[model samples]
Target chain A: MNIPLLSLKSILSRPLSTLLSWLLMSFGVTIVVLILLVSAQLKNEISKNAQGIDLVVGAKGSPLQLILCNIFHVDFPTGNISLKEANNLSRNRYIESAIPMSLGDSYRGYRIVGTTKAYGDLYGAEIQSGQWFEEDMKAVVGANVANLLGLNLGSQFQSQHGMSEEGEEHEEQSIIVAGILAPSSTILDDLILVSIPSIWNVHEHEEEPGEHEGEIIDLPKLGIAVSQEQLEEEEITSILIKYRSPMAAVMLPRMVNEVGNFQAASPAYETARLFNIIGVGVDVVNIIGILIVVISAISVFIALLHSLKDRKYDIAIMRSMGATRRQIFVHVLMEGLLIAILGCISGLVLAHAAIGILAFYLEKLNLSWSFFVNDEVWVLTGGLIIGMLAAIIPAGLAYKTDISKTLSKA
Target chain B: MIQIAGLSHCFSDNVVISYPDWQVADGEHSLILGASGSGKTTLLHLMSGLLKPTNGSVIFDTQEINQLSPSRMDKFRGAHVGLIFQKPHLIAALTVKENIKLSTFLGKKPEHNRHIEEMLDSLGLIELAHRKVHQLSQGQAQRVAIARALINHPKFVFGDEPTASLDDESCMKVVELLKRQSDQHGATLVIATHDQRVKNHFSNKLEL
Candidate 1:
């Protein structure tokens, strides 16, 4: 109590220096913590959405784009590959399972994905209402999609021509909501799922007698349906593959890419590459945070050193009153400790404040934020240690003050 | 009783200062009279154990202060001696009352709040006790410094030109206050000063 009161008075007596030191320290800590939180959140979101899909096969294009389109469901696929060729890879001895996905439509702004019950099985999806789609034009909605679009069991909505809001609407065709999937908390939660026949039927009706007027229409033939004009060759946007063995990871992507007409991408490799690109930006932010923290520590050291020099006479007086060198040393160190603790606490609040803003924005997009990670605790401890280290030199100088010489000079 | 024998000091340049042997009886107030280069402050510091002498010892009764370890020397000084410096230095951050409290804490005594309050009341500083040191006038600050030095009521009180900068009237007042406080507490008092106004305040004079 005695030491604390003395240190508090000393700090209060020099208000401007104390405040300047604290603000700098807190700002530096906040930035460091901000970057860590963002980096952690970004890595978690990417990996969570990717799940365990081992490989993606798409029309020849950027592998990154293939993973983004097929696995993460964030970008448009590079046109489409033949369903026959995609199925051929499904039969590969090293492949455990393959799920094909066809996408070119949206209800509202969320994509309508044409997939099989296997895709739902791959994600461990459970039905919240009704049952899975059994026939053409029957759709199963994901939890978030159902909530955001207000399409419950038995609701119906028409599909748009492409996966964008401005796509031409397929007004003549509407899909019935056969079921709603429970919350998977993955990319699937944002999608409206239907079977493959629905995609073909919707597009098949798109260019019929209304536009043909008995004119010869050049339609790529699908083997299943030549009763009407043959549509374009049957295609799907991509295939998601699960490898049967750990060794398949070495050969699968290479084998699929060797097929020439199509290319293969690994979710891990593509996501790593994407993060490497983003890591450059995160690295810059990290460097800036480190510089700010270092400068804050230096400023604290300077503030303490300058005050120690100024208080020589006061130190001499304390000595005359019989203060031990150790007492004086601890007295000055207390100043540093008080400043550091206050700054650390303020920085934590600032870090949480920034996270609050980020979490709010993520929630609006139907995404959840993860907090309470181990790195945050480390930051708090490291910040306080730096504060104490900054004071060490100044405290030693106070302990070595020559009392009699200082008093005689005074 | 304070005893000194063959005490001396030297600068790195080999300029040596030698002191004549002297004894100050308990409760006796003495003044060391000297000019600017007379080493009066040096003598005061050496005898008070602020600086170890080059040759010889200062013994308060039978205990040789210079022979104590650094920490033990500080403990000894706190319990047995008090000092008033020329400039009336106090911690600028603390109130007058807190400065006295700090002194008592550093004195190595079991907590002595009652003694600090009595010192403040005796020094007429009870009203200004809560005011910060910077807010006090020079004279009030000097009184607070005195109260701090004497709060422990040591066996000896030493002043290093405590009244050199004050006007004659205030100087006399300060010297008289130092003497009266030391007498009431039964501690020996020694003032190192060239100021002529302090000459009449003490009977035993040591001319350096």
Candidate 2:
């Protein structure tokens, strides 16, 4: 009938080759799209969670580990730093604000971070229900922590000693969920927030059983105003610092590393370094995906050229039936274009479905990716260009078919 | 009516075939008789505007087709002429009815499913309308080709050895169908074949 319908029938006439070209194209597109989604989301997650914090000053260890532990919460803490030394560094004029976090305990694999109200402010966190923790043992749960662990207001759970579920539970120090934070699309959504004293009290009960029995020392809330004696004896994990001025960016990290027993790491510098280290593997895989797409284009070219040999007489017959050279040319080109359009659309669908499944399994990372992106339009356009390139020569050959000679051969 | 004057085609420097002047009135059935290598197919191709002659003009009702551009010639031939070859060159991917429908599609004629069905009915192919072309016998495929050629109701029907490979009974049957279909559609029938079995059917002849 019409050229498009005729082109479709011609493509269907040879099933195996068409399938091969289609599968290769879709496979290549899937790989390319998946990589784009993951890398973009990874960069977004890293930067968003690390916003506002100028430096992470923790125990003497790998600066990257210090950042990973205190900022991103994906790695183990280097060790603990004395509260006296950390408080002294917080008093430095270059530091605008400092939030002290004491991390070591968990409840059902979600880390229970102990800090003041400023930690919630750092991420623009808002309470979704109930209220913020007001007492030492009262806890505020992140949106993800609340949903995943089914924690609601007044839900009581004891702290575990370590970050994993197998850690020893401190039954005597039960923590009650005081409130739940709204989803902020940051690392805050994956944590449980408690006061610093809650973590210290849980450990102090085990370390010195009856010595600090009824002496519930409520330290001042705003500036971490512990007595000199208490500050000397207590230890905390890390302090997240914001710079007072741009000059602090150059002068502060050096001051902490040289003057105090601490390692200060810049979140911006470390994440870029991390991406550079991961980029080599990403580039290699991206190259392979592009190579597969190019090969599929070649496969399409060869298939069309090969089929043209058998269909020469058929094309001649169409010409005899009054098909113009241009019509014949467009008919052949439409086949290739059809294959590309089909392959690109299916590839995008396959890629999105795969990412959805991956995001489901890796939900603990709190990663979110979109189903459609602007870069995929380029992928579609590239596919169509390749399709046209592959079909042009074959279509031109069909256009030049000598009708009288071909029909006379019979 | 069709008119041809000073028709000759050149294949190469040393090979040229010239055709004598001829004219056929409207709705007349004529045969071009010749042996192998006698330019019968070439003359048929020129008359149908499939090929442009080196020195000739084919006039159909005062329209000089050879003077038309390639694109216009193709549209002209599609609108006014239908062709059949020695082998039924049906596109294998399409069914029997689809093959007939292709004529109306390419000829830029308005599609009429009823006309296609009637054509197939008269050809005794109504039952096999949905079957793929490869499944049909030689005679059956040729009949499908005839149905395709007549689908657009073209002014001229050209057959180049339409029944060359069939037995005597099938050959005569095909010739009868061609004449009958052309007559029904008010088309002039022009067939080029060396088969002696075809001579008894057509009274007008051009021999080379």
Candidate 3:
């Protein structure tokens, strides 16, 4: 009997219009919320995984590809650079530290990277169980890699020649999991760490079989003690460099690209460029989502306006029953507001549910699907405003209804 | 008591309708008898505070109602007056009981579920209390309207051709219910109608 209850009943009285408006509103909200969630997560993951690396020096190729391959590990290496050339560049006075990465092997779908312990330090990754690899044949599995592939300490698995499941398995040199890294919210969680020689050993066995058979050659511990001559002749995919001073940011990439056989790509510059390129598509879809929301608002407006025609007599009846003009006006407005509130709440629920589904399927992305976001408050407020806007005219009309004239007509 | 002095309303420059000065004491049942174009509905509307008169004063007890502000007038009408139109005009969305309760809500009267139940029981609508207004018969809908009007126990109850659409038996039944309910609630009853059958029921009639 109260205005709110009456308003709700009035909305339900015309079920088709109410449902139509609600669906449009909820659909629009779902699109907008989903876009916000995905873009936020993508930006977060990109920047977080690329943290601390000042430059990526790989064999001359697309700088974006070099970054994607060496830093993000989502693409193929831009061919290998000579370890000797990379080591020479690492010795530059402007270079604080350089972590060499030897790619081109995988176990299951997770890439097995050949690097020193410094690569783990780059992402603040620490051993979760057992210990870091102490020998060339041992491996440290990332948290995701361990969990996804069920790899534990002492689990021996031969490396595959390429990154996919169909790649050739190098059965001659089986690597044992020495440890597992704790979960770090970075691309590191999707990689396996081993000594650089492990990749060389796996490939060398296939290239020159029986050449070192029965020879009493001492194995390097974690491959760090390898001879300079051996290291110079070997090839690695890229070197991730940290600048010693801000001056390196101005002088280093140009020096490496012009003087050395390799190209140095700034991780920050390349990722920003990547986002700029992707932003067009994001903006187009975002516009579409917003357009839908606008259309839903219009739909709400039309529905309310249309229903006002049929409810004129009802308004007059309420007037006769002692409802003030303000009460009548507010009652109409409340109908629209109720629709908006319902649509907004349901849209948010739907968006979160959709994110949950996406997270379930796209597990490799490692997105954190939060139930709430700050931007949603604006969305809610916008919905209520639209609802109020749509109903204001109709409510005004109801407020001005001539009770005597309307009732006398019947 | 309700008093009307110099009451007149104009739809336009040449279509003005004037009413004679009259008074109805508290608890007295009265009738406004006239044809369709004789301004019976206009006078009823003025008395009930539904329309502002172009030139007039309708004083309920000692306070002049037409002089009251629009909001105050609405509140006064809701609290002290009940209106029953020719058609039931029940809000189709509301159940029969809710239609009755709407009066109490808008009139700012304290709702008594027991009173509403007893009101519906007296109207023989207790069985159909939860039914939608549109589901009721023509006579039943008018009864629901009567129930709504009397829900707040208003001092004055006005009916404008309330039983105009009913057959003779139903019309008399509706008039009987209106009079009985108003008497039970200690309310003065005033009805405007062209039907001659309603004249036999009211001795205190104002003819225009």
Candidate 4:
């Protein structure tokens, strides 16, 4: 008891050494904390955005890319599926909801996703003010779109050809901001949402009206519209199905994927695959963490061995006062353990502060990452283990030191 | 009370000292006299239970310390053996009083503030009680170690070349101080030294 207390005081006296070990240990721990924060946030964002939708049926290109573009709001869709195929899928009894999405327009690099009221309802997204789009070329802005573009409920803007920085398009069709959505803390907060008919009408006027031959004749019947008189089917980009029974879970998706031109994807499967992909990187982080801990242990061992020369007389005196070799051993090891604890605490605090600073950027990317996530308890636990593990080598050295030889050398 | 029989020690397989028998009675003031390699320090280390004898036994009262496990011996030593080293081994990070309090904490005893204050008062160290050990002069730090050694009220006290680093005048004063305190506490006192300045102070002498 006296020896451990004495050893603690000795460490506190040597401020520079204590601080050096603390900083070194913190360096390794901070990286581990940062990786967990970023990965978990990205995973959470993808899963949250994938909610409510059961299937994403797109053109026979990259199903992952189409899902990314339409649902997760990243990259370009591989291609579009036919309207007839979309309509036939909606006719299935297992399909509870269908939301058509048309892309290929932007307002100042922010995407303009031409969708319907059903799109908002699928996710239970609400309008902050005004109403959903009831007219063609009308739009409802996301929270970020409203904030970044400074668009009010009645404000009007023009659409661009793509989300590129080239500034190539001059042709503009006026788009009125009919409604704005409350922030969902998801991908919904960043897009310019509008009715699907608005996108169809934009291509209708792509040419100079007088120079185009019979443009008027093709225009009226050009786009597919849902008829008021009930039809057995209708065309759309994708149909998100919610099964009334688990039988549909087994039967309907297989039926949709195999029997039709459209391909069905479960958001659940895609999310699982996304996690598996990210897990490879996490495995690398764990390896690096283990390596850092090993290095930290070696550092502690060397530093302690280095300090033992100066501590010889001190150990001898304690020995003379009836402290056993084992007591001296515990005393030295305790000093190392103290250094580890200091490092672990500092590392955890550093990690929390780093996440707090990056929160804004994370939000901008529509990825919600909290510094104090559920797994942080494990991170702290792991960091402490690393710190203690690092101390063991030093402790072992201290244990093996020959007290008589050491005192004689002095 | 203490007893040593056929105690011997070696460093790097080289014999440093071998003694056939030695003993000090309770409340005796004994001085061990020797040249550089005479094993006076080795005798003190064995007597205080800091070093295990390569041969024979060191009995403090009835306990043969060579047989006690290192950790158990540390507890026994902390509780009953008070040691003052040649150079003060006071922890540099702690204030004077905190260093003294560490003994109590390690010994698992409630703080005896009255005894500490009395020790400090007798040694004229009360005013320096809050100063860091690093801030103390050699003489002042030596006096602090003396105070720390006596604070535990041990039955025996060991001083290893305690005055070797001090000036003549300070060395004489330190010896007088240690002798008077040992007498006041009725504790056996052993001084292992070649200083010769403390020769006349101890009534009982062991020549090596």
- Top model number, lDDT: 2
For candidate 1, the per-residue lDDT at B116 reads: 72
Compute the interface RMSD for each candidate structure: 1.3, 0.9, 0.9, 2.9
Residue-by-residue lDDT tens digits, candidate 2, A1-410: 68899889888988999999999889888888888877877887898899999999989989889898898898999999988778878888999999999999999899999898899999999999989877778998999999989998999999998889899999887899999999998999999999877888788754653234333443433345454456668899999999999999999999999856688999999988888989999999888888888888888899999998888999998888889999999999998888888888888888888888888999865545454668888988998899888899999999999998888886
Q: Which ten residues in a row have the lowest lDDT in candidate 4 chain A?
A: A214-223
Better of 1 and 2 by lDDT: 2
| lDDT tens per residue, model 4, A170-265 | 355688899999988878788888766566556556553213222222111112354322122223344445555667677776777675466767
CAPRI classification of candidate 4: acceptable
Docking class of 2: medium
Q: At residue A95, what lDDT does model 4 achieve?
A: 60
- My TM-score estimates for the predictions, one after another, are 0.88, 0.95, 0.96, 0.83
| Model 2, CA-based lDDT | 0.88
DockQ of 4: 0.46
Off by over 4 Å in 2: A206-223, A367-370, B12-14
* DockQ ranking, best first: 3, 2, 1, 4
Q: In angstroms, how far off is A376's CA in candidate 2? A: 1.0
Higher-DockQ candidate among 1 and 3? 3
Highest DockQ: give the candidate number: 3
lDDT of candidate 1 at residue B12, scale 0 to 100? 63
Better of 1 and 2 by TM-score: 2
Every candidate's lDDT? 0.82, 0.88, 0.87, 0.73
Report residue A298 deviation for candidate 3 (angstroms): 1.9
Residue-wise lDDT of candidate 3 within A1-410, one digit each (tens)? 69999999989988998998888888888888888888888887888888889999999989999999998898898899987667667778898888889999999988999998989988898889989887788999999889989988999999998889889999898999999999998887899899887778888854653233332322222225455545556798988888999999999988899855699899899999998999899888878877777787787778888887777877887887789999999999998889888988998899888988898998887765574668889988987888788788888888999988887877
**lDDT digits (tens) for residues B1-208 of candidate 2:** 9999999999956698999999888999999999989999999999998888999899998999999999998898888899999999899989998888788889999888888899899999999999988899999999999998888889999999997899999999999999999999999999999999999889889999
Give the range of the ten consecutive residues with the poorest summed lDDT in model 2 chain A: A209-218
